[model samples]
Target: MDKCGSAMEFLENKNILITGATGFLAKSIFGGENLEGSTKCQETLFTVKSSKRDDSFGTQLIEKCIILIVKVIGKDLFQVLKKMWGGDFDTLISEKVCLVPGEVSLSEMGLKDSNLVAEMKNQVELIVNLAATTKFDERYDVAVGTNTLGVKHVISFAKQCPNLKLLVHISTGERGGLILETPYKLGESLNDIQGLDIATEQRVAEEKFKQLEESGASKEAITSAMKGLGLERAKMYGWPNVYVFTKAMGEMVINDVKNNLPVIIIRPTIVTRPSTVILLDMLQVTVGYATGKLTCFLAGITAIIDLVPADMVVNTIIMAMVAYELKPSNKTIYHVGSSARNSMRYIDFQRFNYQYFTKKPWINKDGDAVKVEKVTVFNNMTSFQKYMNIRYLVFLKGLEFANKVFCHSFQDKYNDMKKKINFVMRLIQLYRPYLFFNTIFDDTNAERLRMDIQKKDRETETFLLDPKEINWEDYFMNIHFPGLVKYVFK
Candidate 1:
C-alpha cells in the first residue's frame, strides 16, 4: 500500500475536532466565510457524512474523516461548506460533518451542555487547537486569556478524551537568526528569564485589572494601560511584541500539562493571511503600494521575507497530523514556510510589486488608472525619518502655517495627510524589528516529513507542502498580487 493509501485508511471514519473554525486560517480549512461574524452562533452539533468525492487531497481526506467544528457559531462558514456540496448540503450535514459551538478560553471550551461534552470526549480521536489572539500589542488580559489560557483549556479537555490520538497546535516562527524546529520546554523564556510561570502571568493580569477598576479608570484608559502593560512585559521578557510572547507562553502551557498526550506544533512563518500580525504590516504595505497611496518604504532590500500560502500551510498541517499519528515521534516542532528553501528577498518583492501594478494599474473612482512608481526605499530608520520630514512633514508644516493665515482653507487635507503620516510611522515602529529581520527557519523535520510522504506515494503534487518548489516571481506577479487586487484592494 502507498503512503496516501495508508493515510486514507487511518482517516477513515475517524472523528476530528477543529477549534477556532471561524478564524482566517480555519475559514480556508472549511472553504468559507463566517457571514454573520464568529460570536453570534451558539452550541449546536451536526453529524455530517462526506458530501462528495473530489480530486483534491483536502476534499479526499474530508471524504474519509468526520470533522467536528467546535467553534463555528454562525451559518456563514457552513454556507461555504454548503456551496461546496451543492444539492448534497443537507445530506452531508446530516452524515458528514459535526458542528459543536464552544469557546476555547473557557474551561472545557465552555461546553456547558454535559451530554454533548461527554459525547465529544468519547468520539473525538484528533483535536486541532487553532484558537488564538494574534495582535502584537493586544491587551494583556485578552492576550493571556486566549493565547495562553486557551491552550490550558484545550489541553485539559484533551486529557479527558480516552481515545484522543493526537493534538496539533498551530504556532508560529517569527524571531530572527537561525530558528530551529524544537519544542518550547515548560516555563522557557526567549530572554532566559528564570522562573517564567504561566500561573504567575495570569495572576499579574488579574491584579492589574483590579488595580485599574479600584482606581475608577475609564474603559478607554484601562484598555490603553493594558495594551501598554502587555508590550512592556513582552519587552521585559525579551520578546519583540505581546503576540509572540503569549504564544510562546501558550507552548509552555501545553508542555506543562500535556503529560502523555501526543502533541505537535506547526510553526509556519508569515502565511498569506496575517493570522499573527507577522505579515500584517507587509500586507498593508502591499495594499498601499498597489493602490498608489504609498510612496516610500522602510526595509532592508537584501533581507528575506518568508511567506507561505494559507492553503499550503493547511496542507502541511493535514499531512503532519497523519505522519505524526502513524509514526508517533517525540519531535514536536515543524516550521512550514519558504524562508530557508526558496527565500523571497525584499528587493524581489518590491520589483514584483512594481511590475505587476505598473502593467495592471488599479482603477480609481474617477475611472482613471492609478499610476504606480517604484517606492523610495529606506534601509534604516534614520534615513526614513529624514525622508519623511523632507517630503511629508515639510508639506504638513507649510499647511499648518497657511491654515492659520488662510482661514483654515486646507484644514481637512492637512488633517488627513497628518493622520496618514502618523499612522504609517506607528506601523513602522510596531514592526521595526521584523522589517530588517535576517532569520532562516531550519525546516529539516518538515523536509524529512515531505520526503517520507513522497517516498511512499511517488506522486508528490497531490500534497504540495515543500516551499522550495514555489516560484516567487510568478506567484507574486500572477496569483498573489491579483488576489490582493480582487479581494483586499478598495
Candidate 2:
C-alpha cells in the first residue's frame, strides 16, 4: 500500500511472509484469530521440515487456525491456502488462512520452480524471519548452518523482493548472555561484529563447511570447527553460547544490509507453559517431576528451571510487531521478555508445594490418616533428604524396640514408605537445574509497547503480563496433573 506509520496502516494490503511459522513466537502471532476484529491478511508460513521434525504440534496449530477462519469468513478458504503453499496442508491449517509451505533452510525452499521465488519477490510486502536452531545443546555445526547461514538466505531473499516494506525478524530477547543490573544499559557484545557483512561471510563459511562435511568429518570435529567459528564471532561480536552467538551474527546481518527498509527485531525468552500447552509427563522426565520429586524436595536439590508460558511469550511478539510497525523507528530492537517486571522464582514454587500436599491431605496407604504435630518447609533440599535417612534409621530402631515390646511389627510398611520418599527426593533433585537458576531475562521495551489497544485513534486499554492471569494453582492441580494422566500416560 502507501507509506504509513502505524502497523494497522503499515500492514494494510501488506503480504507478510514468516519463517519459523510453527515456532513459539510465530505461534503466538498466528493466534491472531483470537483477536477481536483482526481483519484477515495475506500470509505465508515457511517451516523447513514439515514432515520430519516434531511438527505434529505445529500441524495442530494450522488446523485450529483454519477452522477458526472458516467460521469467520463463512466461505471456502482452503483453496486459497492450498494455492499459497502449493499443497493441501489444509488439514494442517485452520480457517481458510493463506499458507505457503517450504523449508527456509534450503535454497529455493525446495520448491519445484525458480518462479515461486520470483513470485515471492514480486508479491510479498513484508517478511518475518523466526527460523533458527534454538537448541542450546545442539551440535555447534548444525546450529551455525541453520541459525547463521539460513538467516543469510532470508536476508538475501528479502533484498530481492521488489515490494518489501518491512522485514520483522523475531530474535531471542537474550541475544547475549550479557546481563547488566540496570535494564537500559547496553553491555559488551560477544563479538566485535563491527563492519560485518552477513551475506558475504555466509558465502565463505558455506564453502568451508561443505569441504569439511564432504571429507566425512565426525560431528565432533565439525562441532569443534563451529566452536572455532564462535571464537571468530566472539572476537568480532562479544557474545557467549552458540545460540546467542549466531543470533548476534543474525542481528548484524540484518543491520548491515538493511538500508531504507524498516526492520523490527523481537526477542522472547525461554518459553514453557503454566497453563495452556501440554507439558510432557510420560517420560520420567516430565513436568510432574514436581509431584514426582516432592519427597526428594524435603531433601536438598539444586538447578532451577527458566521458563514462561507459551501464550504470554507469543502475545508479546505480536504486540511488538504491532507496536513497532506502528512505531516510527526503523531497524529497531525490542526485547520481548519478562525479567523486568515479572519474576517467578523456584523458591516460591517450593514453598507453595510444601505448604499444601505434604501436610493436611498427605495420606499414606491403607486409608490411615497420619498427621505430624507440625511440618516446616525445608529450604536446604539435600539436608532434608539426609535428615530423612536419619529419621528412617531412628524409626527402624523404634520398630525394633516396639517389635520386641508389642510382639507384632510394622517393619515392611515403614521400609516401603522410606523407599518411596527417597525416590521422590531424587526426582526433585533431577529437576533442580531448570527450577532454581536465574536466566533472568529483561524486556523493558517490549513490556511498554506490546498490548496497547486503541479504538478510533484513542487509547482504550493496556495489557498486563502477570503469571496470575491463568491460575497457577489449577495449572498444577487439574490441567497439569490430569493432562499428564490422560495424554502422556496413554
Candidate 3:
C-alpha cells in the first residue's frame, strides 16, 4: 500500500499508536476514505483524508482544510465558513494517524526495544489497542494471554504514559454476556483469568498436555490434546463459544482496573470488507474465509454473508475517541453494531448471493458464467446425502477421475474435501447461534456520538465518512463489496 497525500493529512498533529494495523477495520479507519461516504448503513463515524481524483489538489475530512482555505480562499467565500470549518471536506488527516510496531503477547507489547516503546508511550496521546485472537476456536492459552492478560498490561502501561489522555479498547458486539439491555453496565469479572483453574477441571487434559510437552508428544497427539482442552474449557465458560466468552473477559478486566484513564470500550459487530479504504485485496480474514464464503466457492452457490464493513468499525472507533474528549470522564460501552439503524438479514444476503455469484462470476470458469441452482437447508446434516448427495457425488467422482488420469488418487483428494467441508459446516452451525439467532443491539450511545459529529458548533473535526450520511446500497453493491467473489477467490 503506497502512501498518498490524504493519508499524510489525516495523521497530522495527532500521535496515535495502534496495536493491530493490518486488520481490516484498523486499516480502513487509519487509511483513506471512499470520500463518497463508503458503503455502510449504520450511523457511525470515521476520519477520511483523500487526494483529489487527479493530483491537482488535496482533500481531507474538513477542519484541517478550513484553516488553510481561510488564508487563501478567505472566510465566507462559500458558506457560513466558521460554522462549517470543522465539517469541511477539503481538509487533510495525514498528521493524526500513526502506525506503531506493537503486539499484545509480550510484557512490553513484544517491543524488546524499550527506547521505542518508551518514546511512543511518552509522546502518544491516544493509545488504540485492537489486536486479539478473533478466531472462534482459538486456544484458551492464546486468547487469554493476548486478549485478557494483554489488556491488563496495556492499562498498566498506559497509566505510565503521561500524555495518554484516552485508551480506546476495541471489542466485539457478540460478547453479549447475559445482558438484556442496550446501555449495559460493566459486569462480573471473567474468572477465567488464570485459564479455568482448567488443569484442575479435567485431570486428563492436564496430564495429557504436560506429557505431550515433557516427552515431546507427537503433533497429532498434541493437536488432539489441545482440542480436548478447548471443548472442556468452552463448556465451562457458559457462553455460546470461546471467541465471545474470552472477549467478554477481556472487557471486564479492562473495566475493573482502568480507573483513572479516560477510557471507552467500542464493540463492533461481525466485521467484514472495507467500508471505505481500498487496498489491493491481499487476503480475507480466516473466520470469514472458512465458513459462509468458502461454501459458495465449492458449490458455486449463493448465500447471504452478513458482516459490517471494516471501515465502519474503524470509523466508530475514532468517533468514540473524539467523544471521549467531550465527556472524558464517562466509562461507558459504545456499540458499533448494525442492530437498529441499518440491518439486512441473512435471507437477504442469501438472495443476493444466489443472484450474483451464479450468473456473473468474476472468473468465468468455463469461458462463460456458471450460475448455481437454488438450495434448501436441512434440519439434519446426514440428510445432505439422500437429497443433494448424489448430485455432489457426481461432481466429486468426475474430479477424482481427472486427478487419477493425471496420476493421483482422486479418491483421497475427494475424501479430504468431504472432511474439510463437513468440519466447516459444523463450525458454521456453532456460530449460527449468533448469525442465525436474532439479537437486537441498542446503539443509542452510538447515535448520540453521531449527533456530536453533525453539530456545526462542535469543535472536533468531521471525517465526512459518516455511516448515516451516505447511500448504503450503491456503495455495498458497486464499490466496496463484490471482492468476496472477484478478489478473495482470485
Candidate with more favorable, higher TM-score: 2 or 3? 3
- State every prediction's TM-score relative to the real structure: 0.84, 0.60, 0.68
Poorly placed runs, candidate 2 (over 4 Å): 1-14, 31-39, 50-101, 106-112, 173-240, 274-306, 351-440, 451-486
What are the per-residue Cα lDDT tens digits for candidate 2 across 1-490?
1223333443455567877655545544554322323444555544433333445544744653454344322222223333444543443343324544555556654333366567778988877787787754444455666676666677777778888767777666343343422212222353433445455555656766787799999977877676566445434554445566566666655666666666677665556542444542232323233233323333223333344565555555444556554555532666544454555454545554444444433333455443322234455656666677686767756765776776546657656766766665544643333344545555544444543433223322333344335555555555554555445532
Which parts of model 1 have CA positions greater than 4 angstroms off? 1-4, 32-84, 273-282, 392-421
Q: Which is the leading candidate under lDDT?
A: 1
lDDT of 1 by residue, 1-490 (tens): 2333644454566777877765666755544222112221222133222223335534533443333443342324355456566786565545645555566777777665588789888888878788888888799998998899989999999899998889889987556689999877787777787877888889988899999999999999999899988988888777888899899989888888888888999997887842211112237778898778888899999988888877677767777877876677877789998888898889998999898888999987788999999899999999999988998899999999999899999999899999899888877877887789798999999888888777765434555577877777877766677767766677
Worst 10 residues of 3 by lDDT: 39-48
Give lDDT tens digits, candidate 3, residues 44-159.
11212222233322223243245333332342222322234455423422223332334465566655445656776687777777777787776655666667767877788789
**RMSD for each model, in Å, please?**
8.2, 10.7, 11.7
Candidate 1 similarity to native, TM-score: 0.84
Query: Distance (Å) between predicted and true CA of 252, model 1?
Result: 1.0
lDDT of 2: 0.52
